[model samples]
Target: MARTTKPLTNTEVKQAKPKDKVYTLSDGGGLQLRVKPNGSKFWLFDYHRPYTKQRTCLSFGSFPDISLADARHNRDTSRELLAKNIDPKEYRDEENRINEAAHSNTLEHIAEKWLEVKKANVSADHATDTWRSLELHIFPSLGKVPIHKITAIKTIDIINPIAAKGNLETVKRLCQRLNEIMVYAVNTGLIASNPLAGIGKANQNPIKKHLPTLKPEQLPALLKTLAFASIKTTTRCVIEWQLHTMVRPSEAAGAQWNEIDFENNVWDIPAERMKSKKPHKVPLSDQALNLLELMKPISSHSKYIFPSNSDIKKHTNSSTANMALKRMGFENKLVAHGLRSIASTTLNEEGFDPDVIEAALAHTGKNEVRNAYNRALYLERRKPMMQWWSDHIEKAATGNMSLAGQKGLKVVSQ
Candidate 1:
């Protein structure tokens, strides 16, 4: 016959003195408190494996740390698991392993890994901006949260305040970063689905403020100011090139000497450097070529047309032209990017084809089919339009803003 054991109360267990040999005070149902000769008391649960019927003892914790009631509660949980034909110890070990994995695979951990892979694909400045955005906005609240626990509703709550504060653009960017990290997690088997998918529509639309630009009448005075400004010659040439080509400030700043083709009178910008991810051809007017010739003396030794002032080996910062404009008392009034708007507005008002104007501005089409067609058809007309624009600028600078050449231009299909 099996030996019968009596349950012990917490007070009786605490009052019992340690003996020469270790002895167990039973709480029934395989839960017991074992007191050692050194007076250390431990709680253990004895159970039989459902499959093999082998007995094993699983530690619940120490006495006082885990009270008699807590140990009984843990024992009941183990009994429930055993009733399902699962070994209690194995189930507990698996639970601990899952918890450990969740702790290690937090949102911040996955974001860092994602960023490390991303840094190699994007520009240094772009990668830096991404990192800074996470550090400032996303990391503080959700960084340590397990990726699986980050729900769409929770994410929207975190980002809605930023949107409410009138930083819809930042909220959009943060949502994009969260989406990327969550996708990375899913791909790596950290989660089942991305919670941040379609979160962008949840944000308020940012107020649109067109970039500040100079009017057609204001261009001549701005041109005159830039022409004789006491600034670096590279800076002056960069500003001139930006005005002539109407390319983005980054495109001009990162221009390489080899990208220029004096024979063909074009500048072929690689797709990687372009915002549209499509290769662009900038038709070089005679005036543009002349500006390049002037710039060669200053930056010819370096590969870039506008090499960095501090580090000649690298290209000049994209902000070089804007900073130059700011120092010329045009802060908030004229930005380097505003030159594109100036060109778009002036050329359109002058009756030039909008397609030609957009092509010259290197604006990408919204759809793939339209973009591919625009890339091929716009080049021919853009060459003549570019020359016309340069001549118009020259005439305007000489106080002849009324030159008539707007009647013969062909309008392309939209």
Candidate 2:
């Protein structure tokens, strides 16, 4: 013989008074309103532990916070768990922990962790560029999403817009980067497996395009346009410096005064700034030296030879030469990087040793031993060849039409 409990109503719960001692008003099925002597009311569900079968109580909330309707809903949920031999308390705690982890393990957060691990293996500039690409492409949409919840379809939706813009290369890189992050998550035990393993297979591969460059004969016209172009003197000097030095735009722009060896007539670029991650010595032609002398008054106090107009502590944008080339109406005709191509073509056509030309360009071949030997063997040979290239540029600057017709095109080793 058991006494069945009556269900509590909202009116009864609201009007229930507290006694000198703690007491409960049962609503059946283990749900009760716990009225304390202090007059505070709470919803409690008494149940047996799943495995131990020990009796215990789980608090839903206070009466006003967990209203009669809300308390009944929670009790029904707890009853379902009990029928499955699951303890409601354990289940709730596990759910809370999972939610906490999801909030903390966002995609951006995990990407940052992966980058920290990445920084040790790559150059500083490469690491910075990698993070910047992620910020520009991936972070706006998927940054806040939990790492585990990121699926391939959602990722493709985000990347499809970039692909539609004909920026297939950017799409390819984004897919590769996302997959790297997913693999990192899997390795770290943050997620079960990588859903983005083959994400790059979805994108159309980007065609490899070389930088637009001018023919050797066209250097005269290009130099003439640069001389009279309506651009800053500092910008013009940067272009000329890169032209004479045969270095990459970023390497030229980031040149520091300390890197110059005035006695040796060379510019020693550190390994960190180089693409091959090796220190390189460029023999400074008289033309390159003249460009340096011109920049001394303007940037002698700053570390960088071409300091930014707004911030003297930093170098000017690497694109300054490119932008100037565009403003001079060389858009799609030539780029700053193409300046290197011009120098390479001219040097090769002039019949200098191919090894010396490659050494001058700081190019590394697949053979590590040969590259090391060339770096040591070619410095003296490269100096005179660099001088000859500068003399050719000088002739072009003065409107000398063709390389074959130019005089003093000889390399005399110093």
Candidate 3:
């Protein structure tokens, strides 16, 4: 006849004393209370390995910490798994691994991985700005939250304070960057799907504010102010360089000597330096060439044409022109970026070809075919327009009491 083992009770378990040797008190159904000579007790479940049918023991925990009821509950759970031909120990280990992964795969961790890949596609400054935005805004709230638990509601809540402060533009950018991170997670199989998609639609759209700029007729005043401004020679040259080239401030600040082709009169800006992420060939006018010639004596030894005032090894800061303008008493009246607006407005109002002007500005188009045509056929046609624009600047600078150019135009304030 088969023998039947009685289950352990809470009273009996608590009173059970350790013996001289190690032993176990069965609680029936493969459950037992193990006691050592040292008086330590542990809960064990003896069961057969699924499919293999080999017997092994699974540890639930220890006595007092794991009560009789808790041990029975664990035993029942294991028995259910055994009935389904699943090994309980294997299942527990897999659960542990998954839990560990979910804990480690935080939003900040995934964002860091995504940034490593993102840095290759964007400029260094842009990549740095992107990370800084996260550090200032998003990271404090949800950075450590696991990617799986990241919801659109949580993101909206985090950015709402920024929106409340009339910084919808920052809020908009935050949403864009967060969405990129989520999409990255989904693509890499870190998460099943993006939860923060279209979250920007939930917020009010930001009002567009154009940078403070001057009218085409007001060019003489700007040129006059810049010519007499109490700033460094390199700062003065960079402002004129940006004015003549019509490139962005950062592009002008980062100009390298190798990019200039004195023979061709073209400045070949690399794709990485451009906002459109395409290489641009700026047709250099005589005025632009003169600025380079003037800079040659000061920065001929360095790689950059516009080396920083404090650090010759590094290029000038992108904000140098703006700060110089402020010191010249044009604060809130105009900005370094407004220099492009001055060029664009003058070129467009002069009835120059819109496509040629856009090409000069390095503005891209959505139509790939037209973009290819512009890249091929626009270079020669843009030369005359560039020269015309430079001549216009020369005309404005002529009588402005500056070092170079002839004078005829009168200074007019806004």
Query: What are the lDDT scores of the predictions, listed in order?
Result: 0.83, 0.87, 0.89
**Taking the tens digit of each residue's C-alpha lDDT, what string does model 2 give over 1-414?**
999899998999999998999999999999999999999999999989988999999999997988998998999999999999989999999999988997789999999999888776665656788899889988899899999889898898888888999999888878887888888999998998999987788788999888899999998899778766777767878888899899998899899999999999999998878888888999998878878877888999999999998999999888899999998898999999999999999888889888899898988888988888889899999999989998788877774221122232122222
Model 3, 31-132: lDDT tens digits are 999999999899999999988999899999999999999999999999999999899999999999988898899999999999999877777668888999
Tell me model 1's lDDT, rounded to 2 decimals: 0.83
Worst 10 residues of 2 by lDDT: 402-411
Clashing pairs in 1: none
TM-score of each candidate structure, all chains considered together: 0.80, 0.76, 0.90
Model 3 has an lDDT value of 0.89
The CA lDDT at 137 in model 3 is 99
Q: Provide the lDDT at 166 for model 1.
A: 88
Model 1 residue-pair collision total: 0
Which parts of model 3 have CA positions greater than 4 angstroms off?
A: 151-154, 198-202, 401-414
Tell me how far the alpha carbon of residue 308 in candidate 2 is from the true structure, in angstroms, after superposition: 1.1
Error of 1 at 255 (Å): 1.7
lDDT (Cα, 0-100) at 129 in candidate 1: 86
